[model samples]
Target: MYQVALIEDDIEIAELIKNKLNNIEFLSSIDIYEGPLTYLNSGKKAPIILLDILMPEMNGLNAIPILLEYDPDALIIMHTIKNNSETIFQSIRSGAVGYIDKQSSNIDYTKVFRSILNGGAYLTPNVAYKIVNYFQTKKNQFNSLTDRENQITDKIVEAKSYKDIADELNISINTVRMHIKNIYGKLQINSKYELIKLTKSR
Candidate 1:
């Protein structure tokens, strides 16, 4: 079971997300906060955080740096009304794991919640597609790798453990390790931490 923190000012929106998350398979619990600072003060390593962009005291974008300081691995999903490039880029740069728009309530929040609950991520289709295109345009840095290597590299970027990667890739654990070792050598990074930072920063 995963414990999720929800920080949104709109009570209705907050409740909606809570209800959606509560129905998710892995999310057994969700702690809702109507303000950004309240959730920030909780100081818990919630795998998922739904944070609103506009809030009293500290906005979500401003609060992101502080939240990262509290839990570097926190998977924060910007719960906001805005979907502009400026807001999206700032949130993504500040280490938000994903984005969710209140105005986008008409969409399938279930899929969004489920994706984030799992090791994958979520954003509205348009936003997510743009982000993917952005990443793809910048994927030239990884062009040195073959197709298989690229897939393995993406799994590594997602922070999958070697055994889990093997299971997902339908390969032997030893083969996974070999691929990982080769990935490390090719990427010139020795640790998962380094791989994530390097890939995500690009």
Candidate 2:
């Protein structure tokens, strides 16, 4: 059995989740906090933390790092109504291991907790679809580029000069410039900074 901490500003919702967690066999206990500040002040560490995004004190996104700092081993899961791709991706980038949509009807506390405990991740079906779609879109964007254009994109992302790329590819500098221009067009990016951001996001 594992202890869990839930940080949500809504008292009613917090109690609801706590009741559901109470029924999970793997969970030994559940502590509900009205906000991140209360949880952080408590200095209590749990193996799993269910966090809500919108709160009067501090948003869950910003609280993620602080919570992790307090207990690096805690598996934080975003339990919120916010299901947009940007928020989902941002939560993941901020160190959350799972994203659960509060409105998802298929939430199985047992399965979710078990999966995370066994070194896996959990995402609501809609959330998972959004993540998959994002990668597919990124893939399609790359696929639109020719093989040579793709190569030049990599070189540019590596901070290589146009002349150096030309020397390595055995092409003239102007040819290298042309390929880069095509890459930028295909990727719909204006500069190396954007190119780097796009690639890193993938």
Candidate 3:
């Protein structure tokens, strides 16, 4: 029986996945870890790891490398409710081999298991669509900005203060303020930090 390690913080969700996997046709065993930190300290190894992305202390995305360090051959599949592009892309960037949506009504456990066994990556249809749309939206966001708005955004990325931006652009501080407000609204971001993060992600 193959051993699968499940690192999930939520007891109910963990139990649900455990029960489902337990009933599968393959002869397998599952070990549950409430958090990745605990799993790391335990010094146990499994060939496959079903990791949760939104855990309490150390999230699954952050745990991928550490887990891989311990066992380089482990197949790490991310399990999460997050269907957003950022989370999905970042999880892949962090070295997760597969992604599973816990909220999919038609989530096929058997197919997920089979895909892993066959050396294929598995992603729910919704997740696949989100990843495609996200890249499309990244391109659209560039066209969404006005020329002046784009310039202001560049200044903001350079850590320019409002007054400094105003002086450089030969505009009043109030003009810079209005432009910043418009930029924030168009970008769908709340703070300078988020703005920086969004641009950096692009």
Candidate 4:
């Protein structure tokens, strides 16, 4: 069983997220902290920590290191509305391995939990886009993509679904997915969000 901790100030949002986690099969318990100060003083730890960015007391960005100091193994995932590149990079720099948008229309709980369970990283499409854009401006090292892969990537950045990309490119849906998988492998990213991010950056 996995223990999960949530440090969020918004009562409604906290409850909503808590309920969502409750449905997960592996999660045994959840502890909610309204602020960083309380979370730090509680001496409680969990394998996974879902933290919010804005709070009345100590914000999530500042709390990342402190949580790690308390428990070095804790996997912190920034669960927030802030999708800007700077904040996303700051969270990663501060120690968060994953960033999820609470405001996204579709939040894949299974993918999120599976990523964390596998010790991998998950980034919402918007957040991933910013990171891709940032790196694209710094250095264009991902020039190995094939032309078909590039076409699919462009459609992805435009927020097209697999069916849309396949239809537009006169290819099968499996072909589109295959190109996306190849793109992810070449770019060292996991989700379509990250792929879209990279395409938009280009």
Q: What does the lDDT read for residue 78 in candidate 1?
A: 85
lDDT of 2 by residue, 9-45 (tens): 9999999899999999878999999988998899788
C-alpha lDDT (0 to 100) for residue 93 of candidate 4: 90
- Model 4 error, position 82 (Å): 1.1
Report the candidate with higher lDDT, 1 versus 4.
4
- Candidate 3 vs candidate 4: the lDDT winner is 3
| lDDT tens per residue, model 4, 1-202 | 9988888999888898889888888889878999878888888878899999889899889889988998999999999988888899889998898999889877887689789789789998888888888787534546778888777777788888899988898989998888888888888889987766656655
Q: For residues 98-138, what per-residue lDDT tens digits would candidate 1 score against the true structure?
A: 88766764767567766765778778877776667767655
Assess candidate 1 and give its TM-score to the true structure: 0.60
For model 4, name the residue pairs that clash: 129-197
Would you list the C-alpha lDDT of every candidate in the order shown? 0.78, 0.91, 0.85, 0.85
The TM-score leader among the candidates is 2
Q: Could you arrange the candidates by lDDT from highest to lowest? A: 2, 3, 4, 1
lDDT of 3 by residue, 94-197 (tens): 77878988898867777887798788888988999998888678667767889998898899999999999999999999999898888788777889998888
Weakest lDDT window of 10 consecutive positions for candidate 3: 134-143
- Candidate 3's C-alpha lDDT? 0.85
Per-model TM against the reference:
0.60, 0.82, 0.69, 0.67
